[model samples]
Target: MAHAAPRSGRLTPGKRDRKPDTDGSPRVSTDVFSERTHLVVRWVLPVLAGLVVGYWAAANRRSGGPVTGWNLLFGFTTALAFMVLCVAVRVAASRMKRELHALTWAVFLGGTFGFVYAQTDKTALRSAVMAAAVGAVVFAVLFYRYYTHEDAEGHRVP
Candidate 1:
């Protein structure tokens, strides 16, 4: 009789082999943890980042202002709005199969930040100028990164 094959309890290999591909990069991981990490990075992290940005915006606006229920309301509402914007951008980029124009989004965020900051009895012009300058730098860096890392189809270049 022919010998039976051994049944090892280990997981099966993925579509790609363990060896490096033509680009000298390892194959994408199919591990369960890796998948979970990807999900968190893709979805949860963006929301969390939005929350942080919103909180900062609200706090900046509230500085030296009245301490009332309105403060709480403003903070919560701003956080919700920011989170929604982030999710929208992510969805749109995914559907379009292209990298989101970080510069445009950065300008939007900076304008939001400046508007909020200007509400705290500060000079609106100064606040806007500062925000725009920072936004420009952010735009430049993100543009370079996205351009280099993604192809025209917006697919990541491994």
Candidate 2:
């Protein structure tokens, strides 16, 4: 009987001896944990920063005035304007990311509390606390999604 042929090195998965492609080698996917770390670094920090600064600014501006009902309306309306302006800019740039929308939403929502501070000044601290709490919760959700999400591009309709 004829002897069986030896397997070629090229057939080996890791030890392939083929010439490298001209463009580039195939990208080796890293482990899941490593990729998640990368996502956290890329997506988490800026989110926290936006929340902190946005909440602090509005809270810091209050100076202990009364919060009349009109003040509440005005505060929310102003924050709404700020949000609309931000959305327009973000939309124009065409750089709108999921997190960017979240950040803006959090800011506009949180900024309403700041507006309240500007008007009534009473419970400025409470508004700040509430905004911070909300911002924290929002980021927590984003962070969880970042680490646990299957796709890197985000917003996969589950």
Candidate 3:
């Protein structure tokens, strides 16, 4: 069988090879800012939430209920639960690169907290609810920015 000449047209022009950098290794870009921000939310938001709860107990749980101490204890416990839930969601969202979703969840949780506070006639709980609501809003905005930044960087969130 006769061999045909190599077809130069099959080869495309401007082919570039991407090699490892000067350290003789491959470096992957992992956006740590989002992770760090999420970490902050995990710890900071919960503590703030706990404070809000304590303040709520001090103000509202102080009256109109037998065993004022017990009332305050319950209020604090509820707030701590909220904090735990929020931290869990924050971690999940950060991993998924969907902070907005987490923030939305936080807002909903704040409202749930508010309902309990209002229903129980606790001023401190009410105050806590208000603070958490405000924080949720801020977190939502920050998370939106974080997601946007990640998208621009061509990160595949999926």
Candidate 4:
């Protein structure tokens, strides 16, 4: 049998020859501004969310009176604590192989709500029950989102 010459056309192009996302897909170009913006958003958004939750908690948990020094102190303290939790959640999410960010946020929100409710001279049991119920719903929705959007190995898929 006679051997035919190897065809170069059948092989894929070298890395240098392949253009970036020229195959009809939208191409995302990230510059320094984009990168910085992403970083800022990553940190800032969480902090802002934490601050909001903290304020809500403190406001609701306050004694029946106008805002006072103690209320301000409590709000600031809660805000600081929530900021820490947010940062911790960010770190945890970065380290996880699976999607758990939603769970982390849910826990924070639910716990804050429960704490504030209990502080209102309400029954601890009732506060806990309400928090659990809210947390469960949040968890279910977020878990469903994670499940449908991510594969078993945690890689996102369409």
Task: Give per-residue lDDT, candidate 1, residue 41.
Answer: 86
lDDT of residue 94 for candidate 3: 57
> Which window of 10 residues has the lowest lDDT sum in candidate 3?
8-17
1-158 per-residue lDDT for model 2 (tens digits)? 89988433342223322444455554332233454676676455445544444444443444445655654554455545555555464454234355664565556546544454444445767768877777667656754654364344554322
The clash numbers for all candidates, in the given order, read 0, 3, 4, 0
Residues 1-158, candidate 4: write the lDDT tens digits. 89987433323222222234445543333222445667899889878977787778777777666988888888888888878877887688645444475677577667867876776777889999988877877778877887786777767654
lDDT of 4 at 23: 58
Q: Which runs in model 1 stand beyond 4 Å of their true positions?
A: 1-20, 23-33, 95-100
Candidate 3 backbone collisions, by pair: 56-124, 56-125, 60-123, 60-124
Q: Best by lDDT, which number?
A: 4
Tell me the spans in candidate 4 whose CA falls farther than 4 Å from its real position.
1-34, 97-102
For residues 18-53, write the lDDT of model 1, one tens digit per residue: 667667865653444545567778888767877776
Relative to the true structure, candidate 4 has a C-alpha RMSD (angstroms) of 10.8
**TM-score, every prediction:** 0.68, 0.34, 0.45, 0.69
lDDT value for model 1: 0.68
Query: For each candidate, C-alpha RMSD in Å?
Result: 8.9, 15.4, 15.0, 10.8
Q: Which ten residues in a row have the lowest lDDT in candidate 2?
A: 8-17
Error of 4 at 18 (Å): 12
